[model samples]
Target: MADTGDNSKTELVQELNGLLADHFALYTKAKNFHWHITGPRFRDLHLLFDEQAIEIRDQIDVIGERVRKNNMTTLTSIGSVAKHTQVKDQDSATLAPDDMVKELRDDNANMVARLKGMKELAEKAGDNATDGLLDDWTDMAEERVWFLSSFLK
Candidate 1:
């Protein structure tokens, strides 16, 4: 509501934190699927999951840079990610191919939703740079969701 400088900066920092947390969770879930998937679809699903995980890992760098540009510290540790992230972790040895696909699809969808919400926040803060970063991630997540969901159907 107010056009105060501190409030705008704080809002941007909070939004960045939330986005970082969600992406961290998505990245972990993708890696989990990559490690655990097995069955008739093993090769396809495994490769797909690995690619998606790497994409998320790349996004982490982009996100961290944006946070630093905003004059805030990036939450870069595993402990911070585990504490702040909303997506649940999986036991890498336990999931079947179908289960892995389903879990990753869900995580991608969730990440897309979170990024969209963050985009709105970034726009409100007049932070087009962060909004553009989220736009790229949202598209990537949606594409991954489609690819992962195809394994189930």
Candidate 2:
């Protein structure tokens, strides 16, 4: 594979594309939960879901751009994303608030797992840029874990 400036970034680019697909699916489901969640903590869950969805949505574009920067084609069509994403679509619009919280928390944990794996790959490729980015992404995702866990208990 050709070097992307310094590193042969094929693996990193592929990981980033996978991240984009996963996060995009998660983001949409976050919004779906935001719109449909109902329970005693309706206000709290609604706001939290909306904020997370926005954060994931913003990062989706950046992840796609990173793929392009690394000389790889990004997933654009919904079909492509569906094929690539590890995250599953929400099965119901009328989920109880607890179920919504549990589902999103699990998804965010999965995202963190991928981010950590990417960090290792980035380090191996000597792609300092990707490694640094993954650090922030991982930490932020870990915090989401904390918040969600707190909500669950």
Which candidate should be chosen as best, given TM-score against the real structure?
Answer: 2
The 10-residue segment with the lowest total lDDT in model 1: 1-10
Candidate 1 per-residue lDDT, tens place, 94-152, comes to 76678778888897788788888776678777787777877778898899899988878
lDDT tens per residue, model 2, 1-153: 336465448778888888989988998899999999887898998999999888888888777877776667999799988988999988798888888899999999999999988977787667677778889889888988888889988
Q: Which pairs of residues have clashing backbones in candidate 2?
A: none
Q: TM-score for each prediction?
A: 0.89, 0.92
Q: Over 4 Å off in model 1, which ranges?
A: 1-6
Enumerate clash totals for all models, in the order shown: 0, 0
